[model samples]
Target: MKFVQPIRDKRKIEAMKKVLKSESVRDYALFVLGINSGLRISDLLALSVDDVTTETGNIKERITLKENKTGKTKDFPIGTSAHKALKEYLDTSSLETTSPLFLSRKGTKAIRREQAYRILNNAARTVGIKDKIGTHTLRKTFAYHAYKSGYDLSMIQKLLNHSAPSVTLRYIGITQEEMDDVYLTLNL
Candidate 1:
């Protein structure tokens, strides 16, 4: 599948939150976990309470999974934001350690890519970003924000379980324009 990059903006995130927070607490948890974990939506959708929140009350060790696409084991430490989101969702729903991390309004399975895209799009429309947003957007948001926060490209690559730094940079949307600007502006 050709991954379409989504524009990550503060407004766009807020719009998604407005929609997600307006619905079930489970949905809000799903959105927060994705943006924070940098997990593929599939991994996020597959999460169970035991994958994150635990009886000890702090998050468990890093999430470990074999990514469906790459078939490689990936592990990422849960960030503060994701931890808080999961806790809130757990508290609200009283989910057990083994229950699915997210669920439908009727408490069925959470959702798949098709339904996830629709849920996010409805939120995007309300927030007024006409740009395309997809299930991958949240995952990309995690990478974009991590890049902006100064995480090394190589480290980000490792976190995403990507094979190369170049691919990671491109996925995070750094471009020749920015590179050229940097080259031209360098005083040293």
Candidate 2:
């Protein structure tokens, strides 16, 4: 499997977001929720409307689920951007409580992982992102920005369900030069 990198350029991130949003609210919400929640594509694709919605059809502030790969439960708060996009999508889409959150064009079931990859790749290409973007890019982007924002490394490791901090470090694509810069800058 070819390695995919996180979107480190803020401009490209914003551009991709814009492209997805302009394309469809469903697409926008999918990307926003993925990057914000750090969920694997399988987990995200498996979500039903009830998973993120209340009985009254309001978006939940936090969502919880058992991960498909790890069999461990994880809960995360939806970020503002993701929340807004989700609300917009919910309002416009003819989705029921049990319907797949990200349905395919036929609306019979959740989209396949391959289709999700195509959507992400097309959006990335539209925004002129030259990186090797793929479904994992969303998860890596979440961890990369979280660590860059000074979020706890242990917390990120747990979120990604990695066995160690070192694995999380490498998963987020941290470079030795960047680590060295952090050491030099933290002169306290």
Candidate 3:
């Protein structure tokens, strides 16, 4: 298996959002929620309309689910960006409460992992991102941006459920140059 890098540039992320949004609202929601929640592709794809919305159809404040990979229950607050994207998608689609949030074109099930990968990869390419992107790029992008925004590494480690700081750093594609800059810039 090949390693994939995070979408490291903010402008590129926006460009990707634009491209995906223009293509399909469901695809846009998938990308937005993926990056915002950092959920694995499996877990994200497994979500249903009820998972993210109330019976009255309002977006929920938090999402709680058991991760497929870790088998651990995760509960996270929905961020404004994700919530907005989801609301937009739900408004446009005729999804029932039990319908898959990221439904397939046939409306029978959620889009497959491969399809999710294609959606993200094509959008990345459209945005001129040359990085090796896959479904995991959403998770890595969330972590990379969180770190860049001054979130503690330990907090990020916990969010990702990683066993160690080193693992989190490596998984998020933190480079030696970034580490060196920490030392160089902290000349206090």
Candidate 4:
């Protein structure tokens, strides 16, 4: 498969949010959760209403899921932005506990990975993002911003289920400029 880049520009990200938010609550929440939680598109699409919402319709602090590819149980907290969007979605829709969090156009099944890609790709294009964006871009974007914010490499590696920090660094597209700065700044 061809490579896809993260949505690295902050302004582009904000523009994407504006587009999705104006279009659909489900789409907005999906993008927000993808960027904040770092889940794969498959995992994100597989989520059910009960995964993120409580019986009383409040967004849960933590979401738990077993990864389809890895079969590993993962749990992560929902950040304020994702939580707010999720709450808005839940409040606006009459979803049942077992209903898929993201429904297809027919409303009978969870949205496919291709559909998720279309949703994100269309938003990215609308915001003038020139990068090669796809469903994987969401996960990469999460890692990119997390690393940029000074999170430990090993920590991020483990969070992304990557085998090593080197892999995480390469996956997130650490630039030559940033690497050179690291070398220039550290003194003996």
User: Model 4: how far is 187 from its true place, Å?
Assistant: 7.1
lDDT of 2 by residue, 152-171 (tens): 99999988989999999999
Structural similarity to truth (TM-score) of each candidate: 0.86, 0.95, 0.98, 0.95
Worst 10 residues of 4 by lDDT: 102-111
Candidate 1 vs candidate 2, TM-score winner: 2
lDDT of each: 0.77, 0.91, 0.95, 0.90
Ranking according to lDDT, highest score first: 3, 2, 4, 1
Candidate 1 error regions (>4 Å): 56-61
Sort by TM-score, best first: what order?
3, 4, 2, 1
Q: lDDT tens string, model 4, 1-188?
A: 56999888888988999999899889998999999999999899999999998878788889999999899999989999999989888888888899999877686799898888889989998988888999999999999999999899999999999998889999999988989998899986
Indicate the residue-level lDDT of 99 in model 1.
70
Cα displacement (Å) at residue 67, model 2: 0.5
Clashing pairs in 2: none
Task: Report the alpha-carbon TM-score of model 1 versus the true structure.
Answer: 0.86
Predicted model with the maximum TM-score:
3
